[model samples]
Target: MTFAEITTKRGDASDGMATGPLGRAHVRADGPAKITGRATYALEHAVADALHCVIVQSTIGAGRVVSIDKSDAEASPGVHLVLDAGNSLPLVPKADFFGNLPPGDTFVPFATEIRHNGELVAAVVADTVEQARAAADRLHITYEEAPVVATFADPRAGDGNPVEAMSKTWGEAEQALAEAPVSIEVRYETPREYNVPIEPHGLIAHWEADDRLTIHEPSQWIDGMANQFATWFGIPFENVRVVSPYIGGGFGSKGQALPHSAVAATAARMLGRPVKLAVTRPQTFTAHGGRPATWQTLKIGASEDGRIVAIDHRGANETAAAANFVETLGVVTSMMYAVPNFRSRQTIVPVNTVVPGAFRAPGKNPSAFALESAMDELAIALGMDPVELRRRNEPDVDPENGKPWSSRRLLACYDAGAAAFGWSKRNPEPRSMRNGRQLVGWGMAVGTHPVYSSPGEAMVRVLANGRVEVLSSAIDMGTGTYTILAQTAADALGVPVERVEVKLGDSRLPRAPVAGGSQLANLMVGAVHKTALAAREDLIALGLSDPNSPLQNQANTLIIEDGMIGPPRGPAIPLGDLLTATGRDALEVTRDTLPEKERTAEERLSMFTSLAGMERGPGIPKSRHSFCAHFVEVLVDEDFGTVRVSRVVSAVDAGRLYNPKLADSQFKGGIIMGIGMALLEEGITDPRNGRILNANLADYLIATNADIPAIETISVGEPDYDATPLGGKAVGEVAIVGMAAAIANAVHHAAGKRIRDLPITMEKLL
Candidate 1:
C-alpha cells in the first residue's frame, strides 16, 4: 500500500483551486435514494427464512429474578425457541474502554440480576414477527424487588465521587466574587432527553457454518462493532463482518453495539439460522441510552463596566448505578470567555435508572443553557446590553491555560448576527415590545464546541474509463457525507463531480473513525485528499515512464486537468489512453492519516499546546473551538403562558462551509433540536418503580414543523487554513450549544420570569 501524509499547517496557493465544489450549494447525492425508498435501512434488509426475535424485559427496577416460566410462550404457535439465562449462550464481560464503556457494571446477556426496569431478561424467537411479539408478551417472570434509589432527589443519589479530569481552577473565585461590585448566582435544571432517531435500533445476524458471522445493522462505527462481535463470539476479527451502507440517523445512540445485538447474534448461532431483531420505539428508551438530566449552579461576578471578573460553575447529573458516565457540563465554561478567577467542577449522582449516553452535543448543550442564562441575569443586574456584555468578556486567549486560539471569530459572529438581526432597534426594557396582544422579546447567546481530528485511512482508484472511486468505512448519517466526499474527490481529480463515486459504510473498505464528535468530515476529507494526491502522483509516474507518451521527459511541465495529461500548453491525451498504452487497467493509491505519533518532539508539543485544557496533556498553549451566535425573537401569550419563537438567525464561524446548502440544513436541524430542548423535549420517569413514563413519541414531546420558526444561517468569513486541508471545523454540535439559552433569555425578557428549570412549561410560568 502506498501512503501520503497531510500535516496540519498553513495552506498554499493550490488550496484555493482545490476549493472547487467546496462552497457550492449541491444537493445530497443520497437524497433521491432515500426519498424514493431505494435505500435499505437495517430492518429493511430481507433474508429468506429469517427468524424474528423479541426480547422480554424485567418489570422490577432492582432485584434478582426468582422464577421464569417460558413453557406457555414456547407452546405458542410458530414459536421456535425461548432463550433465558439458563439456556442462553454464555458471553464474556465487556472489556474496559471498549466501545466507550464506562468503568462500571458491564452489560451481560440474560443476566439473572436486574439493575433497572426494562432490563433484558429473555429472548423469544419465532417463525414470524407477529409470533415472536406475541410469544414474548406471554412469557411470565417473577422477581424479588429491592429498595431502589430512583430519582435525583433521593438521598443516596449523591454517593459518587467527583470526576477529577473535569475539575479545574485558576484563581480564588470566592474572593473575587466577594469584592466585585455586581454578582449573581443562579441554578438551572434540565430533564433527561432521548436521541429518538427516525429509525429505531435494529439488527440482522447470520452465522455461516460456525466460524463466520455476518450482520446487517445501522452503526456509526462498523469497525468497532466488528471488533466487539469478534470478542463476544470468541471468533477471529476477520471472521466477523459488519455491513451498514446507510444509516437513517444515529445522534450518537447507534454508535455502539448494544446488548440486543449480542442476543440476536447468539440466537442465530444457536438455531443455525438467520435471526432479526427490531427494537420497538418504546423499547429504544431503555434498551439503548439517552442523555441524563442535569442540575447546574452558576455564579458570576462583574465590575461596574460589565466586564466579568469571576466565574464558578458546578453540575450534578444522574447516571445509572451500572455505569459511571458523568456529564461534565462545567467544562464548556473553561473556553467560553475570559475571567481572571474561574472554577468548574462536576459530580455524578448514581440512580437506579437507564444508563445515560451521549445525545447530540452531549455536555455542551445543558451547560450552555446554564452558563448563558446566568450571563443574561448578570447583564440585567449590571444594567448592560446582553450582547455588549458578552463582547466585553471575550477572551484574547483561552482563560484556563493561557493558550492562544487556533481561530477565534466569535466576535465576528456576534457582529454579523447583530447586524442581520437588527439588534440596535430593540428596546431595552422587558415587556416593552408587543404585537397584537402578544409580548415580543429578543435574546442572543454564544455557542462553542471543541474541534478534534482522529486517525483514518482511504483508498482512491482511477479506472480505465477515467472515473474515480473513493472508498472508506465512514458512515453517512444523513449529514451529506457522501456528497462532500464526492465533491472532494472531484475537486482533487479535476473531474466532474458526477464522475466520482464514494463507497462507504463497510468494514471491508479502508478504515475510518465513527461518524460522531463532528470529526468525520475533517478526518475523511483529509484521508481522501491524501489518497487522491497519491493517485495523481502514480498517474504522473506511469505517464513519464512510457516511451509512447506524448512528451517522454516533460513530466516536470505536465498538467493534469479534466482527466487529461499534457504539457503546459500543448496537445493533451486522455488518462484512459495513457493507461491503455502503459498496459494498465487502473491505478490505485491508499493513504492513512494517523495521529501525530511520528512527529518530532517539538511538533508534538506544539500540537498538544494548541489543545491545552482539553485533557489532551500539559504544557499546551492554545485551544481550537468552533463558535456560533444564536439570536431569536419570541412571542409570549401572557393569558395562556404560551411562548412561541417567531424567528431565528444563527451566525457561525466554523472555519469554512463544505456545502452551504447542506451546512444550512444541519444548522436548522440542530436549532430545531435546541428549540425542543428549550421548550418541549423531556423524558419522564415514574419515581415509584423507576420505569420511564414517557417511553413513546405520543408521550415524549419533540418539536414539529408547526412549532418551529423561520430559521436563517449565516457564515461569518473565509476558511481557517490551519484547521484542515478543507479549512473547515466541526459544525454538527455547535449549532445547538447555545440555542436553549438564547430562547430562555428571550422568554425572560418578554415575561419577566426567570424559569431556571428546562421545558419552561406553562405550569412553571403561571
Candidate 2:
C-alpha cells in the first residue's frame, strides 16, 4: 500500500535511511507496487464514460491518400469519428517547424507527410476498442504508393532535396591527416534501436469544454506537455492538465508531443465526450520515432609516444521524409580524447523512413562503438594495455574548448574501475584467457554525458491535520522521482516520510524541466530545498507571534527537526502542539526556483563552438569524461556459435550513487540492454524491398527471461558536488556506451574473430 505499510522489518533506522525502514533500500522508489502489479499505467486507466479509439495504419512505407471509403465504418454501431490525412488537424501546422519533441535530433510528424510505415492514416472512434478495430477493417482506402527508401545502404535515394549537414566541427581537416606519422582507418555502423518502453505511447483526453482538456498519458514530461498544449492550442496554460502516477519505462520514447495525443484530444472535441487512444504494440514503431541507424568512418593517427596526432571522422545516415535528423557521431573525438588535428562531419539524408529520434543514449552508443573500437585497435598497434594507453593520453582541459571542467575524475574512474574489475588479472592477448570451451576477453571504454539540470518549483502545504503535501510537476518515468521528491520534502520539512505527501505529474502544481538529460534531481532539488526553508521560517514566525505556545519566546533560539521546534540543546515539542495551542491549522509555503541563470549564461558564452554544440568541460582545469570498465564472462558452445554472457562486472563513475539500490538497478538494466545490443538487437531490412524485415518482436530477438546474467555493478567516485546539488552526471547513457564493445570484445576472445559490427550474428562465427 505504501512504503510505511510494508511489514518486513530488517533492523533499525540508524544507518541513515535507505529502502524500507532502516537499512533496507528499495531497488526503486515504486518497486513494491510494481512487483505487486498494483501500479496504474496509461492503458490501464478507466475514466468515467470514456470512449475508445483505434488507429488504422498504412501498410505501404510511402503513399498519398487517394480515397477514404469509410461508409462501412461510419455505419457500424457505436462508431463516432474517423480521422484520416484529409480531415486531420495537426497540433503543429505543416509550415511552422516548432513543436515540443524533446531537444536535439529534431524531426516533425504529420507535416504533409506519409513518411514511414504504420503511420496513423485513419482512426475510428467508437464505443469500444474492439468495435473500432472491427469497423476500421471494414472501411477501405486507396493509396498512390511512392517508392520507399527504408535502408541507409543507398546514398542516392530520398524525398525533395538531398538532406545532409554536420551539426558541428573544428580544426583544419585535410592538411593535418595527410601529415601524420602513423595512421589507421575503419568504418562503423549501427542499426535502429527502439526504446521498447513496455508502455506503448498513448493518451486519454477529456475535453470538458473547448478551452479545458485533461490528459492521462504515459509521459516523462508533465509541465512540458502543459506548456506545449497551452502554446499549440492557444489556450491558457492552466486549462490543460496532465496526470501520470506511474510509468513502466520511458528510455526516450515517452518524452513529449505525439500525434495520437492530438487525435485523442480531437476525438474528445468532436464528440462531447472523453476519448482514450492507446497505440497497438506494433504501431508504436511507425507512429513514434526511434533511433535510426548510423554509418561512420574513423581515421586516426598517433605518434610513437602513444599521443594522438590526428583524427578524421565523417558520417551519414537516413532520417524521415518529414525532417532530417543527424546524430553527431564525431562529437566525442574532438573532446573525448586528446587530439590536436581532428575534423569530423555528420550528414543526414531524408529517406522514406520513420523519423529518427532518441533511444537511450541516442548518438552516443553508436559513436562510442566506433570510437572505442578504433581506440582498442590503436592499443593493439602500439603494444600497450588499452587502459594504460587511455590514461597516458589524458587531457589537461576539455579538448573541445580550452575551458576547465566543473568537476572531473576520469583518470580516477579509469584507475579505480580497472583495479576493481581486475584488469590486471586478464591476459592482454586475445586468445590467452581461456576456460575449457570458452575464451574470455575484457574490454573498457570511456563515456561522457553532459550534467544538465534546469529550474523547478514546488509548493509545500502543511495541512491542519499535521500532514504536508508537496506538489511538483516533476514525474517519475520509473526513475523514482516520486520517492525522491517525497524524501527531499520530508528531510526538509522536519517531518516523517509518512507525514509528507508528494503530488506529482500534475501541471497545475508547478513547472519543471522534462525528465531528460538526467536532470530530474537537479531540477527538483532547488525548489524542494527552498520550499522547505520557507515552511520552517513560517513555523518559526508563528511561534514568535504567539506567547502561549512553548515555542513563542523560544523561536529565535530554537531549531526545527522531525516535526519538533525547540532549543538546540533541549527536547523539541511537536509542531502539532503549537498549532493546537493557537487553534490554527498549519503552515504553508510555495517557491519557484530558476537555475542560477548566471551559471547557464556563462556556460553558453564560454562553451567551445568548434566542437559543434557539445559543451566543453567549462570551469575545470582538466579534460572531463566519465569512465567505466566492463568485465564480461561468456560461455560459448563451440558447436552452436551462440555466446551467452555468463556474468558481467561494470565499474563506473558518474559521481555519486544517490540510492545505491536504484543506481545498481539502473546499471543492471543497462547491462541487459547492452547484452541485447551486443548479441541480439538489430532492426533487419529486406534486400529485395526496403521494408523492415524484423519489425515485430517475434522476428527480432532480445534478452529475456533466460539470457540475463548475474551483473555486478560497482560505482567509484567520491562525488562531484560542484557538478550539481546531488553530485551526479548523466549515469543513464554511459553504462550502455562501452557495454556493447565489452560484450563484443568478449565474443571475439571466445570465438577468435574480431566482429566489429553489432548484433554479432552467429552466422559470422559459424
Candidate 3:
C-alpha cells in the first residue's frame, strides 16, 4: 500500500494519533518539554558535593608513557585529586577488533605507555569545571614516540598478521575480471567523521555514603551501562544506578558505557567523593568512537547490457592499536542487489587512533556509496536507466535468508520516489537542465535499514484509577519513540492517550535496549502491545464478573476508545467508570519482552528467529536484513567544481511502520546524513603526527539546514513480516544506504566526470 494514502487510521484526540475515525496518536510525551527547552538533559544535571573531573588526553598517536609529572597540577587551588589509569584497579579488559579479547597489565595512563592520540592519559578533580580544566593543562608529560601506522596506505605494513586481522576468501575473482563484458574497478575512501551530537559528553557520579553509586550521564542504554559499570568497576550491578533521563543525541557513540565514564566512576568510588567529568569538543572526537577511515576497492563485472555478473568487495578500515573496533562495510556489497557470484572481505588496519565504534549506517553508509555509484555508472555506460537497472537485479528472496522476503518493496520504493522527485522529466544529457547561471540537476537514492533487536523489559502499570503508566528504560534520540510506545500501550489497553503515561529513560524503570540501530521501536513496543492487551482483557473480565458497574450486564461489546471502555452495543462509557464504581484510583500491569533470540529459542527452532527479540552474548539468529531502492537528484555546476543536492527521494521498506510520521523522520535523517557523507563530512587525521585535527564542529562539516534540499521519504512499510511480530525492520541505519551514489550518479549525469575520491573536492573537478 502507498505510504501517504492513509487507509486505516485509528487514533484519538488525546494524543493526536491515528487517522480517519482513529489513527496514530499525536506527538505526545516529550514534545512540549523539548520544544520549550525546559527539559533537562544528562549534561545539565546537578549533583551535590560533586567535584569536577577533567580528562587529560594524549598528544601523540603512538608512544610509551615515559614520564608523568603532576606535581604542578596537584598544587593548584581547588584541586582535590588526580587519577591516572594506574589508579583504576581491576582493569577490565575487552575484545580487540579482530575478536582476540585481550587483557592488560600496568596501563598507568602516562604511567608506562600511550597508545592513541586521544587516549585518556590522566584525570583531575577540582572544585569547578574550569579549575579542573586549568589544572589539567599543567600536567607535564614526556613520551617515547614510535612510528605510527595511521592509514590504510599499506595494508600489511599497517596491520600486523594480515591473515588473522582480515579474513577473506571468494571465487576466482581474477579469472572473472578478465572475461567480463564491462568492468568497473574503483577505490573509494570515506574519511573518518565525528558524530557531533548536540550534547557534549559529560558524567556526574554521586557516590552515596552507603557505597552505592548513582551516575547521571547521557547514554542511550542505562541497563547496558549498569552492566558495563558493574563488570568494569568490579562492583555489584545493583550498586550502579545509571540515570540518563534525557540525551541530546547518540548517533552510535552512546550505545556503551564510555571508557571515561567508567574511569570517572572508578575515581569517585576510590577518592570517596562525587566526580563530574565532561569532555571538551576536541576531546570528544578522540575519546568517543568516531567513524573509522575507510579504504574500499569494489569490482563489478557486468554484461554488455549492464547486468552484473561477479561482484568482489574488498576493504580495510583504519582503527586504533589500543582498541580494535571494525565496522564491517562489505556486508552490503555481498548481500545487496542480485549479483550471486560475489564475495566480500574486511580488514581492520590498526592505526594510532582512538577506538572507532558504530555510527548510524556503519559500512552501508560508505559501501552503498561505492556500490550504488558503480551501478549508476554502469547504467550510464549501457545507456540504460539506473532505476530500471536496479529493478532488473532486485532479488526476490534474501539471498542470505535463502527464504523469500515477508514482502519486498524495492520496486515500490523506486516507483514512489521517482514519482515524487519527478524522475521521469529529467534530461539524460550532461549539463542538460539549466536555469540562469546554475546548471540544475536532480538526484535520488534508495534507503535500506536492516533489522536490529536487543532484549528489553517494559512495565505496563494500570493505575488504581484506571490510568496507564509505561515504565521503560528506553531513551528517545530525536525520534518519536515515546509517542509510538504510548500509542502501542493505548492501542493495547483500549484506553485514551490521556490515561496512558510512558515513563522512560530511567535505570529505575525496567531495562530497555539502547535507543539506536533503529532497534528501539522493535524492542520496546511489542511487550507494551501485549501488556496493554492483557490489561484490557483483565479489566473487561473484572467488569463482567464484578457486576457492580454500568459496564457489567450491559449486553454490549466495548472496546477502549480514547479512554472509555464502554460497549459497542450500549451508550459509550469511559474506562474511568469502572474505577469510580470500584472507588479506585487506577489499575496496573507489567510484562517484559525477552530478547528475540532467547524467546525464539523457547519456541521451535524455526527457520526465522523468534518474533521476540534477543540480547547480547551471542547465539542470536542474525538473519538477512531488509532492503530498499534509492534515487537521488543532484545539480552539478561542472565549471565551478561545485554541486548542490537539489532533491533526494528515498524509498525504504522496513517492515511495519507503527507510525508514519515517526518513520518519515527516520528516512529523512538517513538520506540527509548520507548526503553529508557523500559531499561534506569527514574527520581529517594528520598522516605525519597521527593526530585527529578536525575534532570539533567548526572544522568538521555536517549538513547545515540549508545544505539539505527537499528530502522526499517513501516507505513500503511492513510489506515484509518475516522475523518481527509487528512486521517491522530496522529502518534508521540503512535509510541513507545508496544515498551518496545516487548523488554521484546524478553528478555524472550533469558533469559527465566520475570523481572517485570524496567530496568531489573542487581541486579534483578543476
Best by TM-score: 1
Clashing pairs in 1: 403-621, 609-620, 609-621, 610-622
Q: What residue runs in model 2 are displaced by over 4 Å at the alpha carbon?
A: 1-27, 89-113, 158-176, 595-626, 687-690
What stretches of model 1 exceed 4 Å from their correct place? Answer: 1-19, 96-107, 547-551, 596-621
- For residues 573-601, what per-residue lDDT tens digits would candidate 1 score against the true structure? 88778777777788889887756458674
Misplaced by over 4 Å in model 3 are 1-25, 89-102, 105-111, 154-156, 159-175, 546-559, 566-573, 580-585, 595-626
lDDT of 3 at 625: 62
Q: What TM-score against the true fold does each predicted structure earn?
A: 0.94, 0.90, 0.90
Residue 748 displacement in candidate 2 (angstroms)? 2.6
* Candidate 2 local Cα displacement, residue 390, angstroms: 1.0
- Index of the highest-lDDT prediction: 1
Give the local distance difference test score of model 3: 0.69
Tens digits of lDDT, candidate 2, 242-338: 8887887888777775767777877787787999998876777777767787778888887766788788887766677666666657656667777
